[model samples]
Target: MTDALSPAARLALDEAFERDAARGGFAHRGAVAVIGDDALAAAARERFGSPIRLFHELTPIPVAPPEGCERHGLVPELVDGVTLVVGELPRTLAGVDEIAGLVARHADADVLVVLAAREKNLERGMNERPRDSFLEVAASRGRDKARALIASGPRPTPSPAYPRSEIVSGLDFPIAAHGAVFAGTRLDIGTRALLEVLPAQLDAAALPERPTVVDLGCGTGVLAVWTARHLPGARVIATDRSWSAVSSASRTAQLAGVADRVDTVHADAGEGIPDRSVDVVLLNPPFHDGRAVIDDMAHPLFRAAGRMLRPGGTLLTVYNSHLKHRGALERSVGPTSQVARTPKFTVTRSIAR
Candidate 1:
């Protein structure tokens, strides 16, 4: 692990490895895999002679593995034959469940999975979800305010439950989502709020007969598919940094029968999209970095919207009311005005100059 590891995570990793060594040296027998390219990955590389593979769901920086190691998307092949998997625990229970399932089904039967995180970030079902796939789940004693969950003994793996699909209330077609994507198949409050005012804003805006729409940070393809369905001539580009979200959004667009109009791109802040080319932008900017609620997460999307919008184009956003992001929207995109508001969320429209 990195020298910068917090005290808790350091202690948890020490305990986790000590336990694994005591249990017949399972880690030394086969390939090691790491879910994130962080401290856990560094540790695995040091102890196990370079991680066989590394995976990250959302990374703006390209993963450049050392000589022998390789980087992979969240595919089943990531864990194939791996005997030890180490990483920071995911924030969501569904994310934990998906990781557990992938390891149990694809990794070695005797594989040890060590997940560590700050104690405050750990929550219910973090340990319980791993138990569904493994025969044993144990927690390390809390130290330095960090803890770890170690799962071993794979059970008979069941069919994967990820990329789940369901029909949301307001939409005519079902949305699909991988475990890590925010809100899964359900439309989140912010997106719902924005959707309520979107049609009117689109109508009022001076858009072309066949304008190109960009769904920035599109989670599960809700806005992209909805816009494609409502505006038959409009082409929708759905973009997100998370591979899981991109995969889920692609599946959602396909299921909604709008795949031809809705294109999914795995990108950070709409990177690779030509500047000043988009006629309309839809965004429900994320506010959380891991489990910590912060306003910084939304800034990039706001700036991306500003750069992508054509002159006289529209940028529609929904955000937590308390974040008070209207000023940022104006500074980044253009003149902004509130379009709708609920107790918890506010939807705004910005005009590109």
Candidate 2:
């Protein structure tokens, strides 16, 4: 097992091939296999030599195994003579059972297993027509289930960019986003309208030396980074339920030369932020995760802001015109007022007593 290969993963490949070569009759039959991750696959290719054929995602097994398969596509034939296949999905989830069955049919049945992500939350947050709470999808199957765990520590992120994301924003602030795909360039319009609606004077007189502000459901950290630039004296804290968002926010802050004034946290906004420390809060609340419509995301954030703010602190956010922010703010922060409103977004201010 090339388990302990150093910097060059090729060492693992050499080990796997040598081990396969050493085995006898059973080995000659071409002990077919599947890999745990891309790292393992690359290593194997190094030792075995390449021009290898790669299967895309999870293709169903061929009924006839393709007569003279090598003529159609060169399937690797080894001493054991079994065919090996790898999946594009780093992890597998439900309904992939058929693919798993197909892999077993082609390779070693007992060896037919899929690799999963180390953590579940690292799952990509997907939005269909994106309407409250984001429904996240892991890079591959089993990752959604968090099966690749070791004894301790945090679950790992897929390396080598298994979970690829389009970096939408400037290097000034990082926005390595995954889970959802955007067709147009730059951040979403809903976000633009929301960020643009943020009132510059909301906390001007209220804040002390560079008042701290948080973009609670910060999707791209666009609002957070922009707030930093717009409010030079402001210390910005960006928090998102999505880890991808946190990473993006951190990078955005770094690029903006405000990393010292910016902090990104991965905790759920529902659980609340560090107690009683914020002076201003900004948000662009989402209405749903995919097709399911929900309105609970802004609740905890509203409450959190009320608890964390300094007495007369302000929770500023922009919401879709269809949503009413009055009831939520009234219950959490005593009273709320509309700062700005348009067909798509309404900028509101909640005052903490």
Best by lDDT: 1
Q: TM-score: which candidate is best?
A: 1
Candidate 2 deviant stretches above 4 angstroms: 1-176, 180-185, 203-205, 270-272
After best superposition, candidate 1 residue 151: deviation in angstroms? 0.7
Residue range 235-272, candidate 1, lDDT tens digits: 89999998888989999999989999998898999999
Q: Global CA lDDT of candidate 2, please?
A: 0.49
User: How many residue pairs clash per model?
Assistant: 1, 24
Model 2 residue 271 lDDT score: 40
**Please, what is the TM-score per model?**
0.91, 0.53
